[model samples]
Target: MVHLSRMCTLVALLVALAGCASAPEPQGNSEILNLQAEAEYAYQLALLDQAETLYLEILRSIPNYAPAWFRLGNIYSRTGRLDAAILAFERCVELEPENQKALYNMALVRLKQSHQIISLARRQNGVDPQVQRQIDGLYQALLRLQQHTPTDSN
Candidate 1:
């Protein structure tokens, strides 16, 4: 019984240490900071391709970097890659649930997606009842989001 107790304590300590060991370091590395600056500069300059590449690189080094994910989502949205934009925004929101920017951007991307779907259906000469139902559902969801979102007083 004594040996068993000792083994359990050792395992518990090791597990705790492992959890601490896996904790991420603060994003204070010079290289990461440099990349962040470059990425922001590129984005501001409207060099979306370069911005996307830099943001992706930052994400690879720091998967929990919510800002990088948010920028990536914006880049994807501007390039008309709505699905990818939604996915990137979703990741950002996952990392920072209180991120109003991510949530708002995601809603915008969803609206764009609905527009594309409707346009495509129109170009095909008819909207399937099922597809129309889905589009209506999307509109309803957007309306709900809008109602709940606080308008800027500024």
Candidate 2:
């Protein structure tokens, strides 16, 4: 159920952003859309680094483009670059606070951070300080997000 909701939210956000772009768009930069399509294809093919580069190129052309930021974060998360994933997700959220997909993705990444610490604790007697600090930070962000965001099933 949660996965379905996230997928719906992601699709809605993509459609919404594509329609109501503030500065970016298929019209202003037709090539940007083409690049996005190429990036997505690379992503589907599991060519994460290539997709990241393509998304970064799109961002360079349109800094405020939320979809690029969100997609970049997705690639980062899949590639296990947690810090960069969070930053990219944060950028997307900054551009679109109502982006439920980004919000949900942030929560997933934070959970992944904690899972790393849990795995570390199981392997050794203690967790890494850096991982602990990152988990703490993500916890705080989740707390703040809970206040502003509805504690609904989504």
Candidate 3:
């Protein structure tokens, strides 16, 4: 026969496992899933404005959702809203540090902003030293990102 202490331990383990097995699904999981599907569909259709609104709605409910952040960044980048794009991508990276796609998009947005600044400076006669320094910094950042990013052969 088993010792009393060992029997108690076995019973406790069984009880814990039973509780876990009976745990109910989280509330609103299906709602969130539906919203995510709608957002992805809008994004695929290139309905950027609609997608952006949907993403914002999802984020209000789940602020830490990295995919919504990434999609929002893409919409902002395509709409020429570089500043907003950077912030959205940065948030996505904060939530999922290993997300290479968000990092790459951030670099692209920064490069576009740099090009715009340079163009404006040229049109105004000459580049300001401070502006030139900022552009150089952006270039250095891009080089660093490229060096650290892994290439996908496929």
Among these predicted structures, which one has the highest TM-score? 3
Candidate 2 Cα outliers beyond 4 Å, as residue runs: 1-28, 123-154
| Candidate 3: regions farther than 4 A off | 1-27, 127-154
lDDT (0 to 1) per candidate: 0.73, 0.73, 0.73
Range of the 10 consecutive residues with the lowest summed lDDT in candidate 2: 145-154
Error of 2 at 63 (Å): 0.7
Supply every candidate's count of residue pairs whose N, Cα or C atoms clash at under 3 angstroms: 0, 0, 0
Clashes of 2: 0
lDDT of 2: 0.73
lDDT string for model 1 (69-131, tens) is 888998898899999989998997787677777788888787777766665654564458887
Name the better of 2 and 3 by TM-score. Answer: 3
Clashes of 1: 0
- Measured with C-alpha atoms, the lDDT of residue 15 in candidate 3 is 53
Candidate 3 C-alpha lDDT tens digits along 65-107: 7778888998998899999999999998887777777888888
Predicted candidate 2 versus true structure: per-residue lDDT over 1-154, tens digit per residue: 4356446655764675477556556563556667878988998897988998998997887787777788888888887898888998899888877777787888878777766765555455346888667656666665565467542121
